[model samples]
Target chain A: MRQLSEQEFALIHARLKSLNIRYIEVYEEIFDHYCTTLENVPALDSQTTIAKLNETFACSVVKNMDKELEKSVSKQVWIAQLEFLKFWKHGVKGILIGLVGFFALAISILLIPASELILVFLVLIFCTTGGIYFMKRDAMNFSFQHKSVSVSSIAVIKRVGLLNSLMCWIWIMPIVLSGGNILSNNFFAIGMAVATILSIIYSISLIAVASRLPKSTLL
Target chain B: MSNNNLIKGSLQTIILKLLEENEKMYGYEITQRVKELTAGEIKITEGALYPALHKLEAEGLLSTEIQQVDNRVRKYYSLTKDGQKQVTSKMSELQGFVENLQRILTPDLKPGFNI
Candidate 1:
């Protein structure tokens, strides 16, 4: 079989990129496959081979490649989700310990005057928003680090971040809308507990998805 | 290539069985190997080949490793532990299916069946 020259490989790579196969892993495989097939077709030069390859793949090229990319990206996301679940499972003891310590602190805070409780609630809101903002910025930075990742894969990461933000909203909206009525009422502890739990879940998900982005770098 | 419909359902199994024998293979090598083995009767289209490979990898039945060869990267796929186990079961299932198919097509091949 004839070995492809550097220029030939570059041309093939460019063509695949033009077809939106931005993922390096997929791009390399398709490049090799095209080269090998062209090699088997004796006497065909690089230009003709490329044209033939394009013609051969023209029918379902983009559709099939996109579908494959989507499958692979979603699988990566699914694996990250599973890892996040595993992290939660193994971190259960630590979570329980934290919860116990938190409840003790909450009880002590509750014993304070209502004015102090309002101040604590305000601080909690500020901290939660800050945490969410930083987590999102970190995820976006991670996505940015991978230059050759497909648009679809980046979209997956964005969707996950959006979901985390939405979850944060769901946790915080009621507390804000009630104008601290819930905080003053008996449900203050329950509301805070729910918010804390949701924040923890969101953080785990963010970390998992962000961890996957770094692996998306081109080979 | 000739009987795409027939080959479609068993593509993954064929790939698994091939990897089971060959240890590891790249995408084009698998296609050529299939063609050669079948004497060019069964041509695995590139379109079908990649999606199957990705799906198998996603299902934990295959794993990939990339190696730089002659100034280019080649992605080679091999069966994982789960994939190894799956191959045995899948091959047996396919064997059973083929036997059933043969019996139906050639009813006389069965002891009590009559055409």
Candidate 2:
């Protein structure tokens, strides 16, 4: 078996970038497949493997189908994310953890001064977003793959930001509009507390789900 | 024997059964194994294979891991506990389908009746 030189590998990488592959996840897998097939299948032994990879991934009308592959992969990612929402559906451990989590959150909310609670929420959200960014940064190497958003992580951050917007609209808008301390008001304070607790739980679940995504996470 | 639709319909079962035995396999390895086992009668197409894999993964029957092999990273798929259970049911379902197809194709063959 002839080992391809670094130049040949670089050529293959460049060709893959031109294949209209949309997702980083798909691109990475195909890159490996292409390289492996080319490396393993000797021209004298089996040129068919190389032909197959080239025909489908690099050099033919397989472009349409490759797009479909990317779409299917994208769909798979979305489905996996949705499934993470049901973390407690199948097991007692998850429910127990959730129970423990909510209890801890309730205690924290109750003990912390209501006036300072808004700062707590801000800090929690900030930490969650920043943590996810760092995790994604390690997984993605932008110099290798030509892509946007690294791993759809930016889109997820946008979704997280959207949640923050909704929370601000619900909890902070009234205070700003009416020029009053909505935090001191019992109705809004209790409402915000419940909302904040639920948000924390949601963020925890989101982070938990995001954490599980390895290099396969794509946009 | 080279029926694309038949193989397509059974691809998930084939994949799950393979993972059940091997415990873990990558996409290209799965194709090579199928070819080796069938003596080249069944060649899974590149177009069909990845999408099917993605679909099965989306269904939560398979999970993937990435390891750096040489210069590139390979994504290996292994059956989840749910996937292991599915292998049994999918294999049984495929057997039932083949049996019914046999009955239709050979309706004249009857037991204990010599004509």
Candidate 3:
């Protein structure tokens, strides 16, 4: 076999990294599996028997790495396939969400009372649209599973956002449905509407911040 | 090699040389072959063996095929044309080094140990 150029080895190293493989392990595999004969002993000056024994222990990892390199797939295709799976998963989720939302909206329109019908219809529409928009945007972001993330922060922020968005929709839409009855004695409705808007904005901001936080910093 | 450092340095050469001769080999098969030839002196771990193999395949010095064998999938690796040339050059360099070392350490061998 030929000696590898530094550049060539580096390239191979990079590919291995992408595959999430450890380099030392590769060397060990190779040494253990292929380079065993006395004739194949590495060119090194030491106690003949000990050299072989030490090499078995030393190249233990290095040879394994080589053996792995002998067996694994190229880094490029592996990453491509992973990315494809992620994209497909995102697409499936979006479709399922849309279908379920649509079905609920249809059922509500047919069964609900006239006085409450239009308001419910509009709320459902707003939620479906907002969710679809967010889903599409998320798909474009393309986060890798291997990439780090802050789970606690993300969860907190997401919870806040969900609450806020929910409040925003439930509170404001009733008034708009009532054709903007500003002077009405609907005090509870007015307060709920105000709280909802505030919560929605808060949630949106929380999510924005959450997305920017580095994975390493995540709790 | 004397120790880990030397093995690390020459690992690629060894892999390239083996592939040059055999054309292709699988992970387990390569491991077994090395053990057999060395008489169980060199031991390779599965952990380290896989990554390096992957890296070479990525560099285009080697190519691969994944085939199902006995209900399990196995990935096979083979050297490219450039890899073949590389193996030749490395082997010659290693041969020269060994010869030089022999002369330096055994200066009297030419006449005194000729028998």
- Calculate DockQ per candidate and list them: 0.56, 0.31, 0.16
- DockQ for model 1 equals 0.56
Model 1, residue A114: what's the lDDT? Answer: 46
Q: After aligning candidate 2 to the native by TM-score, how far in Å is the CA of A148 from where it should be? A: 6.7
Q: Write the per-residue lDDT of candidate 3 for residues A1-219, one digit (tens) a residue.
A: 333334433443343344432333233233323222322444342236333434443434444543444334324333433443342455878558646744664565446554454365446445643553353242222555432222223333344446646755665666577775632434543454345344433433344444442222211
Clashes of 2: 0
Query: Judged by lDDT against the true structure, how good is candidate 1?
Result: 0.69
Of 1 and 2, which scores higher on DockQ? 1
What is the Cα-based lDDT of residue A104 in candidate 3? 64
For candidate 2, lDDT tens digit of each residue in A1-219? 467767667766667767756556667677777776776766454346555567776434345445555555446545656676686773998888888977776787788877677777677766776676676664444686556233345444545767778887986688797686766676665777788776776666567666765545431
lDDT score for candidate 3 against the true structure: 0.49
Clashes of 1: 0
Off by over 4 Å in 2: A20-24, A43-52, A58-120, A138-145, A148-162, A168-185, A211-219, B1-3, B58-60, B63-65, B109-115
- Scanning candidate 2 chain A in windows of ten residues, the lowest lDDT window is A148-157
- Using lDDT, rank the candidates from best to worst: 2, 1, 3
The lDDT of each candidate is 0.69, 0.70, 0.49
- Candidate 1, residues B23-112, lDDT tens digits: the string is 899998998899889999998877888888888987889988878876567889999999999998998888888878878888769653
Q: In model 3, what is the error at residue A158, expressed in angstroms?
A: 24
Predicted candidate 2 versus true structure: per-residue lDDT over B41-95, tens digit per residue: 9988767877778778767799888788876678899999899889889998988
